[model samples]
Target chain A: MSATRVTTPVQSVDAQAEWELAYRSSKLRDCEFTTLSGTPLKPLYGPDDAPIDPARDLGLPGAFPYTRGVHPTMYRGRLWTMRQFAGFGSAKQTNERFKFLLEHGQTGLSTAFDFPTLMGYDSDHEYARGEVGQVGVAISSLEDMQTLFDGIPLGEVSTSMTINGPAPILLAFYIACGERQGVSPKDLRGTVQNDILKEYQAQHAWLVPVEPALRMITDVMGHCAKHVPQWNTISISGYHIREAGSTAAQELAFTLANGMEYVRRGQAAGLDVDQFGPRLSFFFDSHLDFFEEVAKFRAARRIWARKMRDVFGAKDPRSWMLRFHTQTAGVSLTAQQPENNIVRTAFEALAAVLGGTQSLHTNSMDETLALPTEKAVKIALRTQQVIAEEIEVAHVADPLAGSYFVEAQTNRLEQEAETYFKEIEKRGGVVAATEAGWIQREIHRSAVQYQRALEQGTKRVVGVNCYQEDEGKGPQIEILRIDPNVEREQHARLTALKKRRDAAKAKKALDDVRDACSGKDNLLERFIAAAHADCTLGEIADVLRERFGKYKEPRIL
Target chain B: MNDQKIRVLVAKPGLDGHDRGAKTVASVLRDHGMEVIYTGLHQTPEMIAEAAQQEDVDVVGLSILSGAHMSLFPRVRDELVKRGLGDVLLIGGGIIPGDDVTKLESQGFAKLFGPGTNTEEIAKYVIAEMARRRAATGGRR
Candidate 1:
């Protein structure tokens, strides 16, 4: 055997020496030169930084191990769905907002339910009294869901609902809404954030226990496979985890881990991997670090594609694609200098686009103050338009493919995520790890570290730690204020609906839901029947909550 | 000898599931030598008031980001007042507008912190307010 040695090129060595000499003589900012996740950065990246294999790591777009992109033509074929996550006040008001966005060129619809609906509580429930229509629209029954999509044709438009704990019930209501619009389940297209695992790990919006929630998610997957083929049963989300203070790699690892766990559960439930896997989607957060966010998205695709094909033994190329929706990080928005959020959101959205997202939501600048007003939402939507039309970023796919820095960061993220996967496996997979509060503690540790860094000025959030200004004297921007009467009106409407509906039929539907929850019958079918029978979301959820008790998050420090 | 710590009951007293702020504040309070009791999600005003009374917390911090402060905060305050624990130093935080802050303050809240509020400021304010209350009550109740 012959021994081989590698050495740096003479010219490259001389360039490195000159670079070190210049670095020693020049002044640099006295701050950590690292990514938000603490990945160290050098002054420059040469070929030595990352050795990329063109045929292996950097494969062609739309091919197996899709690191570059999921689609071949990418944006040139079709721009990402510009979905603005808008919901607030009553269903009527939010419906008006939805129409407004659609009129202004929103390509998709994303609904954000109020806390009551998210927690599977009726608007008139005592626990939901004050919070009827605060954060998002309060949809207690199919009536509210119907009002939420009043004039908009559900068949023509794609919708995404960001509800986890009550995801099945919400999706049922949505399917019922579609039926009212003369849209069959087969033609309907949308996604439900049925990613319950993340709720226990980060969001804390979970309703049922872990085992029951998994059962419900698998039930949805099976039902959608047979019924709503185009519908994404679960949008495996990292957005909430990122908002909860996880680093970029942590978000990627935890999100993909949850996705794989779902795949495993589906397989365990005797469902073919290809049937359900193709419809599974992902949701990610685009934060301030531009290159890091882009690299994270790239790494996510490569990892998912490889895992789905190589590990899961999936033959379908569609199942290997990591289709994701990106939202600009809400945690990155600042209240100190509220207008600065506009710039932050623009860069973040651009990163998502450059990272090859299938859809994107640019957060409104005034979200830190309150729910976005019409004007603020218009600007947020216009940010995407500017990126698509003015910026012309969609002219080519994977523009940053060969950049040494981006590739190195992508490799680093992939490696870090693999390490986390191993650690999570050691802790007995995602569900067990989540139940034992390990995942939450890991996220909390990063969150605390990041908060400490921000407090100590090590992390320079513009207009937060560094660019100080008196917010009391800043330009007063108009903020959206939900009318206090929205709650009263929604409660009254719910009462009126209850009076008009068939009480006995609703009771029977809820009983059937309980039966389905107890037995092996598909819960989605029962939920759909309940939605049709005018049983409120809280009713269906309560029936299941009775059988499978509510989850109390373990106290993790 | 019993250990002395500033006991705080950090509760989310509404339907809002956004707990990033609440968890961060709880951690900060705990780090600053305060014993934080975080009653997880979906706590009603009655539940919060009962927990505060039972835990005997020196401070009650309600985190409401769902724009229901006008309705929820007053209910919590009324519950605490009805329970004869009005001196529990009720404070609030979340995506609250300035106008609502004034309204909540007039309704017996100590102060309302908004987004981007420093944890140190919150910690310092709690300590200072507790000391002031202690001084006013002659170090009793």
Candidate 2:
């Protein structure tokens, strides 16, 4: 194997002597200086590091195998959408926050749901007693969803909802809200994080079992293809995977593996490749590792484009694009010196832009302390603006494309991801691997290793491991406090809505949804009908839970 | 031999679903010679209290990030008290504000670990609390 490949010897004796002299004179920290994944880095990179045929490997942007970018002009034509993720308290409260963001020059709206809503429960559910309007906004019924986007024109604004377990019902609620606003389904454009495979692997917010979940996702794909043509039915996500502790290469490989699984399932469901493929999108995490994240994004686009065009035989060029939204790493934020997180988020957001993200969400500085206040959210939005208007990094497409270090890192990431794909294939695909606990174990191992490094002082997190600060001496920042009355108000509103809605019609619609779950009918239409009948989210989820059953995650540790 | 193990029930109360902190803490506790039982995500207060009783854990750690600590933590504490397991140490972590931490401690929580808390500090607190409880109970274990 070694004889078959070309080898380059280190022939720069003068450079080596210079490096040794500097190394001997300088006093360095007693820790390993490497990438986030422990990949050793050299002081300098040269042509030998990434020997590439530019014509073959480094193609132009918007061409086949789009390694540089998916668009011809990238950010020069139109800036990447400055979508700020905002939500908290009740629908009315979050609606105010949404309007505030839009007024402050936010280009798009990305919603964050409260815990009960994310877990597919109503505010009044016994299990959802204490957690109604915390973390994010609470949307239980069509009424809540309507109020959540009351004045915002659905046709004019693009919205992204980050909910997974009950994504279909939430999407239905959103469509119903749009229709009430006189916006046709075809005019509505947005994304729903309907990526359940990642839920089982990392995020743990899944509804039914694996087969039923995939079936429902395929149903959404087909349903949107015919009716909601502009809607992105699924945002296959790697954000949660990276936040859960996977490395850059693992995030790229596992996310693309999940994306391919969705593609295969769509094909198996008899949908044309181009019909549903164009609407497929992705979500990733921009962590503290700058070059590694940029490389991960570049490698993701190239691998996805090749697989879609060659392996899957996608004919449309739009089907080959791998557009993604990025949110700065929430796990990277610290509570000790909370203001330091502002600098961290700015760096991560800049890396996401340089890597050519279509949309971005910069996490608020106080997130590690609590949900972000309005003031903190505005600062976070300004971070993105400074990168776009002031920094001027988006003036060129793939600005670091030809750099020796970045190109080499991108190529190395691609090779590592390909190796992961082979390993996953040997374990019988992503779904099988997840079920067998292989994928979860891999993420767990990486997480443990990273945490161990942090504990052992190998990694330096400012204000955490190195910069010691007394508890009372740190800067005092105001934290957002969710009103305790929010839950009571939400419960009352849910009660009023339930009483006013025609019980027989809602019950019949829910029964229809349950019937569809048992048969081969697409569940999206039934779910929309149930949404029209004013069925609560928990009601819809409970109907399916009776037939398909909930998913019990396998123990990986 | 069974008494030598410091059994701990680690649970996520409510619907946060971000388990990096919980799992990492579980691993750290296990590494520190404690038997950790992780109950996974979206566990209600009732489920957590019941697990603490069934596992007979020396400590109950509730990891909440949804800012529902004021409501959820008290429920877990009251549930354990109702079950006559008030002697079991109750601890919490994850994104809780300083004011709420003071209130939670006042409500009988042994410790409220916030973000950036060192894992060694948590292990030390748990071990010391268990030893203190054993001494008070006449070393029943």
Candidate 3:
């Protein structure tokens, strides 16, 4: 409508006094001025509000304590990977989807397993009843893994698996699958959501107790650093934490603490920080809070760099860089008006790019009702493509770096995260604090508070709170339904595989897995053997569970 | 007429770990003066029925987000029938679609709320239903 209206820089004190005088007489809308988390906000932030010393705190891109960004050229050098999480039904179904995504210009692959597989149950297990390949693909053994990536060349593409409880088994399956395709372990590239502490803190998927789980993580990190050099052994994630309803600051604080705990554990297990550290990556959620989410990402990099350098004493610069993958907030999607979620995802993805993430996944609009249809997933992907091609935001690194609002929010988040760190330390460590339900209670408090605000009309969520939509009046979206036949087919396939595989080899492999759990041998090394011997995921996980024991979560309000 | 407090057991009856809605609903129901018992996570259908019988709960609310409702919800309702807790109202909420919600409602599920449902509405509905059921049944044992 109009060209930019430029303004001259004014003195901080004089401008504030003038603004304050006008604000007293001027009428304002009756609304809250705080952040989504209820953090108090200033009307207008100036240079004085941002007390950051750019030299020390905001170094140039690719420099020490990379608050600006991890790369010098940023997206100019390479655009952030557009990797969408995809899976459902059998491995055959998901494999077709994988090739479909790759053909459509998706840069990387992120796999989602079904609830039964995520919880380490086979299709035939009693606990797996009614849950085979409902949420994601069911990969019960090496045979399924091979079929899942049948035509795809592992040496060329990087895969990210969203598996935690049974991460080692899945990783071994991938390695064995790669070998079948003539890809060596050294040539393999990808990451696993191997951060187990968060399983207790938020995402409640785990096979063994905390102590044994932590041990398995250390074993994976140690083995991967030497063998699969390009593989990121762990993606310490805050995505599930935020999805579980933690505030932006809590998500940042808890995730960094988990990362530090891994470093501590790896060190204690006689592993070099520089060796495993460079491959350590992060995954975060890009929530609806625009400035808060951006600042959370910026502060995350700064806090992680400082922790890696000063606290852990890692000399390698790569080890200090906090590389992360982000996914848009799924909880923010309103099922009442499903189409509005596309706009929500677009804004959240922009925040991630501006905040400088290495990769991103935008949730489909129809995700809240069920797994997304093909059209929904495609639109979600195209949202990112348009942002990258249509918008000019990608040209600049840390584009919002100098804005007083962004810097202030970033500084405040860094300080808030530090306060949580001290509290977590006071309770021994991340494990002890999580075990005691302190972290969960904090998350619950935030979640309940948000709910209260939404109910009270203090927080306006378009379809839910403010703009009312009559029931059955809005357009209905077609949802993808999981075939009931998927379960029976999976069961038959598992039974047939069990019938054909050598019984002695499978049993011996499982016995070795059990021994590895009790003895000093690396568990992943034994897992690879089990994968070679055609051992099922449940077969190996069952042995590990028996040896390592099960974890019973402490109830939290 | 005797006054009987509304007792609701908010159970997570599947492998899904999404308890945010369940926990928030439990907290909200308690604020509205209802006795709320939450069966934390990863409870099977049989375990849910057993918990309801042990707690003698008036209502059982299951929250499942893993898309297993078609297979799981019926089994829970059946288990309740087997345990003689058939009078217990069964309701749920999750990522369930419209067709499935209609189908579930026909199968004895009192009402199933989906995402973006107001907790206040749930509380008010529970209270009203408890009153209507209590009046029709004469009195509780």
For model 3, residues A43-70, the per-residue Cα lDDT tens digits are: 8887667777776788889997899999
Per-model DockQ: 0.68, 0.67, 0.73
- Residue pairs with backbone atoms closer than 3 Å in model 3 (clashes): none
Expressed as tens digits, the lDDT of each residue in A18-56 for candidate 1 is 979999899988899889877779888866676677677
On a 0 to 100 scale, what is the lDDT of residue A231 in model 1?
97
List each model's interface RMSD. Answer: 1.8, 1.9, 1.6
lDDT of 3 at A545: 81
Model 1: residue B115 alpha-carbon error in angstroms: 1.1
Per-residue alpha-carbon lDDT of candidate 2 for residues A183-264, written as tens digits (9 for 90 to 100):
9999999999999999999988878899999999999999999999999999999999999999989999999999999999
Better of 1 and 3 by lDDT: 3
What is candidate 1's TM-score against the reference?
Answer: 0.96
* lDDT over C-alpha atoms for residue A130 of model 2: 75
Candidate 3 residue lDDT tens string, B1-141: 446778889999889988899999999999999888999999999999999999999989999999999889999999999999888878899888888899999999999999999999999998888888888888662
